[model samples]
Target: MTTRNIESTDAAGTVRVTWAAANARRLARQGLTAPVDGGPAAVTGAMVGAHAQVLSAAELSVALRLDGGATRESVRTALWEDGSLVKTFGPRGTVHLLPSADLPLWTGALSALPAGRNPLPQSVRMSGEETDQVVDAIADALADDDLTVDELTDEIVGRTGTWAGDRVLDAFQTKWPRWRQMTHTAAHRGALCFGPNRGRKVTYTNPHRLLPGFTPLAGPAALAGLVERHLYAYGPATPQHFAKWLATPVRWAAELFDRLAAEGRTERVEYEGGPAWVVAGDTDFPAERPAPGIRLLPYFDAFTIASQPRTRLFAGAAYERALAGGQAGNFPVLLIDGVVAGVWHQRRSGKWLDVTVEPLPGTLTAARRAELEEQVERTGEILQGTPRLTVGPVSVGAHA
Candidate 1:
């Protein structure tokens, strides 16, 4: 693929860059390509974390990074067996598989803020005092033993009050623990994290016990560190986009952005006529692109979901099809040369894994077509299955 990186500064101190449309493919490849050779924790550190609401998606997300070097079982081992990764609530109040050692930074930065706006009306919401009590109850209950959500809810209501047992939220087609909403609160506060599964049920434990002598940064320090990490991986973004991705208020994101700019930690640039920020001194725009290939990214894979400015990544009808409802994780995406090209799905028949792709017609070259087939086999290898390939639409994901 022909690639170009153009950069210029006008006298008024504004930066402008225009890339041939193919540049979109190159820039994304730069950002999304994983250092799979670096292992699971390295992959987690690079992408921040894997969207883990679906355990299988999280496993596939990390396993795909291996580029066939590892499998779903290897990723699971890292998270459960090796203790190198931790499943916890990260940005946007979602569960993610983050590096175990990064808990201090992740929790310190996230919990410094309050839990999200309650979907329930104010009358039914947990009060600040009650919320704090729930947090305390969670920390206390899971100090020595991992407990399922039901068990923890029982303990929490018992410790706090029967009022805490009232239904407050619904998710994943079931009523969550009244304290379930606060579980994210507990996670952000570093009070709770995932334990080995108790059969089919998910369980929670205290991260403190798993990671000893952890020294969490103070609020401001952690915020700065968090922003830096984000910019390092996904920068040249506006504060508003940052806020949206983090699910924080724009004022909060802007305030942090201002601080980073003031500290010489980041610089402003124009991306498609809009001003954006990047880590200072991080302007490395190489002349050539990485080897072109296809990646069948898992649902909510960091690359597919986290990158922003829809115009930059999606072109023409590709955007409308790839994000049919403007939702990212609803389908596994076919990323050709980094930019999203179409949607895909897989089905299992005994040991055989049948894969399907719905491309934007003419998007795939003979070489990319070959790479797409290779990616299908790689997907099965990562999932520890065999592979078959078919092109065209296939129904998949929860949205369908």
Candidate 2:
């Protein structure tokens, strides 16, 4: 629904949203400290989708949220055995483990969004029509069976012609055929989803196979639903943040935010940087705050990726060390008191997980130190492993 315009609220009045409060609100809203009890799907739903570029990271993302010390085995069982979660392309063409039941909202909202502006010059660039053709070809080719990237590429080129294969994307200091790039667009179009792995190879399948009678959101009706969900999880947000999170153009994101406001589903509020929007009646700041705890967030956790501003995430030099490229997926972060306090790494050997924490040159209280131990123990329990920690100052900055 195209909303006329947002009602004027002069929101940045009376209620002051300090950066710390914004962070705290987000921490509570994301179900980080107090995860919902509906199993992995619930955690995934709250997160929108857990980044799965590295599969284990995705599993831990859910494990840390569920009750009863959920483990990676549970995530595996849910995906491979239970069919409750499906891996697919999320915002920015990245792989994410999405709740199977929510495919309609994801595909519908995603497909409606704009494509990336490829200004890579003609030699390596693809035209808009070519991209669309590739997306359609993929949807048709994968109608029945799962296909590896090679198999899908062959089918796609066969249908769309060899020109579709001529374009290229560069990564790891090497140029690769561009056919793989269309996978995200294919996913956006509901044409492709991750199939169970074949040995060491990753494969793509039709999401409909897992979600019977699945269909893209019947227009923006689904997108409107997603807007509500996004705001609920990461409200007090600006159009730019939503745009970045969805990988949609800023203009398009702004349009969606405006539509929500026009519908009275959202209201303006005074946020740290500027005025922002939140789900209506969400102005209840300090609503029964959840006590803060230590959490070790995996790379690209939705919590880190959702909001745009980082001032609240990091205080000073910590921002530079934690987010050098202004990207969230670079490394795992340590969350203490609802802010990024350090970085950590895990090495699992047999039944024990060797954890190394590198803080931002600060000291934890005696209580916090004990709490950190408890948190590490919990992390081990969630992974179904034991914790052997090496706690000391270490360099874990983005590049380090």
Candidate 3:
């Protein structure tokens, strides 16, 4: 019988389909909060954020995907070949680092949408052209001066108008760098700083801008590629899933998928009785293993978004709905084998790192408990034996 018939697709069964997916999806991922120094989280966050911890552009490409620790060959190959992983201020304007090659295509699609309109009043607002001018003004100012968002916002508002408080500050200081960083980080092959001055906090920007020379692909090609990549990375997924991921209209996602199949960039796959698309790959079957164990996952990892009908991976009934809502503010999940067994949070208090978890329904066996302890030890090692660390219970539930 095919592995699809089984409730749990183990490591052996999954490897053939995609090797990285298995390594990426641990039994239960560990959690670390701000001030919890050391560990893969900080490095991973920085790489994906595309700032500080500089590596050769080439090394950055592979490192973003956790391909290998910073290496000249791996990073360079990713930059030249696959495109560096670019973090887009995407969807509801949240940060997402995606494959750099997709930037031009993604941005073009985004520009076609009606601008959501800045909420500021007319006197305070700049026309589209003026907004562009202001962004240009800010960029040019930063070309020589790395002013903090506050500094930049103050200067720009002072130069152009008043009322340059929190909203204006956020737009210039926070949002601008994040949006531009995705385009300019790798494009310029340099960093964008929080302030114009050196030694200030650094925000990563790709070397390129979204408009003009990036010269996005035409509509058909752009939409097609977007659909293909989405399915390629997250498959056995529905149009609704793609719509949410891309923040595109449901109809648009459906149309794009149809176009991809028509173009042969994707092929339809079966999930239960439903139709889903997958990028054609030589691998078959997910890795094989039992359904019980411990794994820890990161925030916004692809594993969490690949399929809308998460019941394929999550063992419980309400697991999908509950987690999706909670994800808006919290991450750091705990898994028992293949199932989402709990949720966790971490924070640093002085020298101690406080970690807490709320388990999902189901009793964790003694062996499973032991397995969890070992994983935490491994996380401690990854953090290079931090100042201090502790994990405990806050509130946990099991979704039967």
Candidate 4:
């Protein structure tokens, strides 16, 4: 099948595309992308990302336009209906979601990792027999009681044999072991979630089983479905992105995307000036604005990492700082006129969310400056409390 990328449509460099039109195209291209209207009737379900598809809960929620107050019901709806959450490959030996329904196609396009490629140093590496035993031990121990990752990890290490070294243990467990317990959930849907070490009241769930699970995948088809879903929402991505997101290798992702494309089960679009593929069929771009008004995208939002080329979404200079490490390093960002203007952080005070904007090296007209502050106020309202804004120093072009 043929694929298409964006071509210069007009005389001037600007593409006359309406932001709204672009938004629709962008969202539709990835079937898993959804808008969360406040409602109780939305469909939702827990996604068990297989090896091919892997995504963080935060990633899934953001792509679905879900608010911080989103309930399990809302998450499940996005997963089951919009098909955004899939069990696809990603970072640190875990799975993540992309879109929906695209999981299978994406999985099929890639090849699975070799049976025995461990990144751990030889000193701490588990022998084949020991690795098997460790997995078995965890499966047996978790037969009852929902345990935290730390608790389960400690038990596994203790029961395995002896503490070889700190590095050895770190290499062995990595993130997979925890992901395994979380995703498997055995007979239950709940897995061990991670929270700050002390005096913090926050926790997040992971959905992968590095070893085995209570409710293990019925078979390979289930896993394939998860992978396809990922591409549906976060497609037009490189195999590297998939590997980074799924903690798999580029070879596996490349194979999967190729197969899906051959089967006519996927479509390609121009993203960041490259041919990008998605499991969903052809879709149109958003006509006018990508979304209604200025948006305060949360940390790790899809817009942060959706396109393979980070520069497309972020300013050339700010994008560098934001991605000094890699895509995993998510900095909360600001968007004006469908472009990255600056980055911001929130300071929560009881019922208020104060946003501090980091101005770029440009001058802003008085009206435009007011518009930016107004957007910040609307953000405060959406956050449901008093809102305060603080603007920072100005720059050359847009003047501060």
Error of 2 at 216 (Å): 0.8
CA lDDT, every prediction? 0.76, 0.78, 0.44, 0.45
Ranking by TM-score: 1, 2, 3, 4
Question: For residues 250-304, what per-residue lDDT tens digits would candidate 1 score against the true structure?
Answer: 9878888998889989888777677887678655544555544677877777766
TM-score of the candidate numbered 4?
0.61
Report the C-alpha lDDT of model 2 over 1-400, residue by residue, as the tens digit. Answer: 1111122334454344555556666676577767777878878888888999888889988888887568898899889888899899987788899889998988888888776677665677666798888888887888899898788888988998987776477767866567666678788778889999999998888887898788888657878888888878787788988887877789888888888889988877767647788788766555344458788887788888786586667667667766757777677888887878888888799998988877777645667777788878877887778898877754545522
User: By summed lDDT, which 10 consecutive residues of candidate 1 come out lowest?
Assistant: 19-28
Residue runs of model 1 more than 4 Å from their true location after superposition: 1-6, 12-14, 17-34, 114-116, 168-177, 397-400
Best by lDDT: 2
The CA lDDT at 236 in model 2 is 75
Model 2 residue 238 CA deviation in Å? 1.0
Total backbone clashes of model 2? Answer: 0
**Which candidate ranks first by TM-score, i.e. highest?**
1
TM-score of each: 0.91, 0.89, 0.62, 0.61
By summed lDDT, the worst window of 10 consecutive residues in model 3 runs over: 27-36
Clashing pairs in 1: none
Candidate 3 structure, TM-score to reference = 0.62
Write down the lDDT that model 1 would get: 0.76
